[model samples]
Target: MEERYALLLERLTKTEPEFQKAYRDSLDMSWIYHDSALEGSVYTAQELKAAMDPTAPIVTDSSIQPICEEIRRHREALEYIRDFADKKRQPLNIDVVKKIYLILHPEEGDIKTVKYRKDIPQHRLYFHEYAPPDKITYKVRQVLDWVNDPETRRTRSTIRIAARAHYDLLRVFPFASDSGKVARLFMNLLLLRGGYPPAIVHSTERQRYYEALKGSSATMTQIVHESIENNLGSVEKLLEGHESKGYAVKV
Candidate 1:
């Protein structure tokens, strides 16, 4: 897995400007599609790409408009998160995460997200429960602090750190909605800052994904680490094919 990460970094260095942009687009759209899936979005990659376009004809079916708007907001949120890739930016801070929460939900009328919710919404995953609303702020801050802890940084692999942060945030359940989305983005922010490609948890793995969360943090971390490693392996093969100028993934 580390080898693949190194190869990916190397391949990135060798890419032409065109390949770089295409690769970034591939990563961004993939993240958006799968993260949206985790949050009950039904849009496919093609539908998401179309909806993200400014010039694409708007769909008039009001029934689907909600989904379309959801995709639109997600794309905006993802873009906002991506900007944190800058080395000068702090990616995992409370302010940054709150900004992400705001971006994911833009229809709050005049309500800015100032504090954690007092509502204890039930999870679709059986046996899943969130932190108490009163303790939400403290729990979230603990996770954020852990992400920045020097000892934690010195000991854990980037994958483990990301997985831990993701799992811990879910345990905290910071926002009223889109908590999973925020958690995944938070994990990827760590990965990207550490020079790793973002991880993808497919909708098809919904059961396993949730099950991991339900089990233990170690199990969940392994699941996330393996998912990221596998995705990087796929990227490596794709890059090799691109280097050979033969068609790789049609995606």
Candidate 2:
């Protein structure tokens, strides 16, 4: 899987800058849509467009305001992680995780004041068992430390590290709400930091995702691998289309 991904990345790097940017623009919407859907929030096509495109006219309907706001906040969170990945200097830390949650839920206020759940709700639906309230902070810190360990980073495939990180963090279920979303974002943040594309766990695969969480990180690893391969295939097809149209394409 790593070998195939390396080759794909090499090929993708040769594409025109404009083409790459356009592809990323399309990806941003899909990423937002699927991530939101995983949290049981679905956005209409028009709503997604309005939320993502800065040039789109302002939305005026009162009823749709909250949906649009949530979508926009999700987009902002995505951008934040992407930018952090590009910089490649900031180590994955607890503060960074808190900041991401804050970005997704700005109404919650300052990062320093962010708190983990003190009690698990019996009524809420959860895919997997969570760490006890007392263990949340310890488990979260451990996961981050493991992810940032130099030996782990040097020896493990990025996909494995990312998958395990996502799995382990979600197992802890650190936050009261949006823990799943934050875990997904942190997974992509690690992927981007490692020079890989973000893995979109599509809404269609929601059942599989939950099931995988119940088992091992290997299943999640395969899901991420396939998602990236699918993305590479899309880029390959686009470049092939350009070539067929008599436009120059790098080999």
Candidate 3:
């Protein structure tokens, strides 16, 4: 899996830079749509897909406002996260995480005001209780420290970091709103910074996605790796067929 991943990354660099930019932009749509859907979006995948295309005709419907607004916010947040993730050379830290949380839900509050919750929160459906409010800040710092520690970097696999980090964020449940989106965004930031593709959790696989996060098992990591592989595979197939055409990859 690693070998194939490396090969695909090498191939990506060979594609036209303009095409690569467009391809990456398209991924923004996929990540936002699927992530929002997991949070109980009522919009169909096709509807969400069409919504992202500027050329698609806009029809007003107050009934679908919830899903549309969710998608709109998620798309903006993911774009900002990717831009920051691509340029930063420093280790991931609490500040970075908070910035992402703020981006994901700007309506909640500003940077300083929207720090970790000062009260406990619970995930009833999953029966997962977050760390107590008093402990949330410290535990979050520890996770960031692990990401930056040279020893952990040398010993831990990206799968472990990505999977465990996702698991930990869910357990921490740090933000007042959009904690789930922030968690997924932070996970993808790590992967992208490490020279890997985004580990998108498809909405169609929400059952498995939730169960994997709940179990915190190899299956979760496996699902992530598969998403990355699937992304690369699509690009590989695209280049094979349209190497000279400079194709735009659809999400």
Candidate 4:
């Protein structure tokens, strides 16, 4: 699994620089959301893929700066976290998220939200409908501890580790509005750096996706394993008929 992931990363890195730039730009644009401006509007996976076309219409340089900065910070933090994991020989760290939050929202203080209830256990199950009474800042330290814990550092397989890291963090719900966005970015960063192809669970998949995560406390291991297996299978299929031609960029 590790070998395959490494090979894919090498291939991705070696892709034409112009294509890489375009692909990265596409990723950045797809993540931005706005209710008013075209540049700010929410993008579905299909729209995002269509927008990736080098020939497709797009907002100009002036419109893309803010979103680009956020993407840059995300990728930069991802690189840092990947390096830290390799050097420290540990599971993903929560400090990485803190660093990312600061980079993405430097002026912002704690993310405001309702507080968690006293009746709920700190490590207990997630309540989707009930909003926690506290803001995101309150959970930062706890998130850090959860990731850096020695018991969570197991590495029998890269896929398993990466997938579980993603699922567990999603369940943890460390951020207010950005949990899904952060998880997707963080997971792809790990996959790309740790030698796997980037995977995005589209909004279209939200229902099954949440269902898959619903029993997370008891089903995390199984869910992670299944997700990894499925992702790896897709990679294998992509390799079977892969061509550099399809991904070429005009810019």
Global lDDT of each candidate: 0.76, 0.84, 0.74, 0.50
Runs with alpha carbons beyond 4 Å of true place in candidate 2: 1-21, 247-251
Give per-residue CA lDDT, model 3, range 181-246, as digits (tens): 788888888887676778888888788877876675577788888787787777778668766575
Which model is ahead, 1 or 4, in terms of TM-score?
A: 1
User: Higher-TM-score candidate among 2 and 3?
Assistant: 2
User: What TM-scores do the predictions have?
Assistant: 0.85, 0.89, 0.81, 0.55
* Cα deviation of 26, candidate 1, in Å: 3.2
- In candidate 1 the C-alpha lDDT for residue 245 amounts to 82
lDDT of 1 by residue, 3-101 (tens): 668767776767777787777667767777777776666677657666666667787767767777777777777777667865645546788778777
Which candidate gets the maximum lDDT versus the true structure? 2
Model 4 steric clash pairs: 5-195, 34-40, 114-132, 114-133, 114-134, 115-132, 115-133, 115-134, 116-133
- List model 2 lDDT by residue over 102-174, tens digit each: 9988878888788898998686545678899999989999999999898998999898999899899889998
Best TM-score goes to which candidate?
Answer: 2
Model 3 stretches astray by more than 4 angstroms: 1-22, 45-51, 55-60, 64-66, 118-125, 244-251
Give RMSD to native, each candidate: 3.7, 2.4, 4.0, 7.6
Report the number of backbone clashes for model 2: 0
Off by over 4 Å in 4: 13-15, 26-41, 44-93, 109-143, 186-193, 217-251
For model 4 the TM-score comes to 0.55
Count backbone overlaps in model 3. 0
lDDT of 4 by residue, 1-251 (tens): 66766765566575677655754564444334221122123544445444344565564566554554454454455455456545544445555554555555555554342322333245423334322446334554554564456565563444455565666566656654445545555665565556555554444444555665665533544544454556566555544444434754233
- Any runs in candidate 1 off by more than 4 Å, and if so which? 1-3, 9-19, 88-91, 109-113, 246-251
lDDT score, candidate 1: 0.76
